[model samples]
Target: VKKIISILQAARSKTLQQWKELDCSITIVANEAKDNVRYLYTLDKYFGPLAHASPVMMEHIPSLMNTVFMIYCTSPYYNTSEHMTSLFLKITNQMINTCKTYLCEG
Candidate 1:
């Protein structure tokens, strides 16, 4: 679990770095792995616990949430995939609930 958390944090940092370095045109490269709803489920299941248990993990939540929202809003997946769309909605709702719980407690 600790290993998974470390990897997730690293991935988030790398993504934010890439977002900062990208050019203005904003070209969308379609990656099947990233577009998969199952992957989102995996992320939620793995990271959700860490977020709940560790303050350090919770600290990255806002940035990670923003990055995810921006990606989904801008990606082609936003328009397509009815099933995955529902999954994304559920994931977002779960994320919101988690954030609320943490924020209120903190």
Candidate 2:
């Protein structure tokens, strides 16, 4: 679980780096991954195994939440790809469902 947290942090860092270095020209966005939407997929892969995990860590949740927001909002995934939108919702819902306590101390 600790390792997973580390990886999510790395992914979040990478996403930020890509966003910071992004180059846009109306036709396309050129960066490290070339498509920021890919971050969602990357995060989804990890979030899958944790869907049913007990005691999900709060450390990872914020990293993924922030990274997902950055990609889904500033990138082309914003209201463009319903597929990605569904995926984003799925992953976020997974987090919210699994880590409800962290959302608010209840």
Candidate 3:
């Protein structure tokens, strides 16, 4: 988990740097998105299963959520490919279910 956080932090830095380097016109160009789904997919792969998550992991949720939101939520939602949209829904539903189970178990 710590490694994941470290990676995410590094990615966030890189993304910010790239954003600063990009011109205002390039940001609006179509089909320039590269592996935008990777974030969503990788997140889904790991966050897909939380049934055995330790309480300690839950404690990191706030910090991790903020990092993830800054990294991913800033992207425009409309440009997502169909595949990404599907994965997004899957991940969203999976997370909702995990939250329900986690809270109900308490």
How many clashing pairs per prediction, in order?
Answer: 0, 0, 0
Runs off by more than 4 Å, candidate 3: 1-45, 48-80
Off by over 4 Å in 1: 1-47, 50-80
Local lDDT at 8 for model 2: 55
* Ranking of all candidate structures by their lDDT, best first: 2, 1, 3
Model 2 TM: 0.39
Off by over 4 Å in 2: 1-37, 79-85, 96-106
Overall lDDT per candidate, in order of appearance: 0.54, 0.57, 0.52
Ranking by TM-score: 2, 3, 1
Q: Please list all clashing residue pairs in model 3, or write none if there are none.
A: none
Of the candidates numbered 2 and 3, which has the greater lDDT value? 2
TM-score of each: 0.33, 0.39, 0.33
Pick by lDDT: which candidate is best?
2
Lowest summed lDDT over 10 consecutive residues: which window, candidate 2? Answer: 18-27
lDDT of 2 by residue, 39-78 (tens): 5565764564456545644456677767666666666534
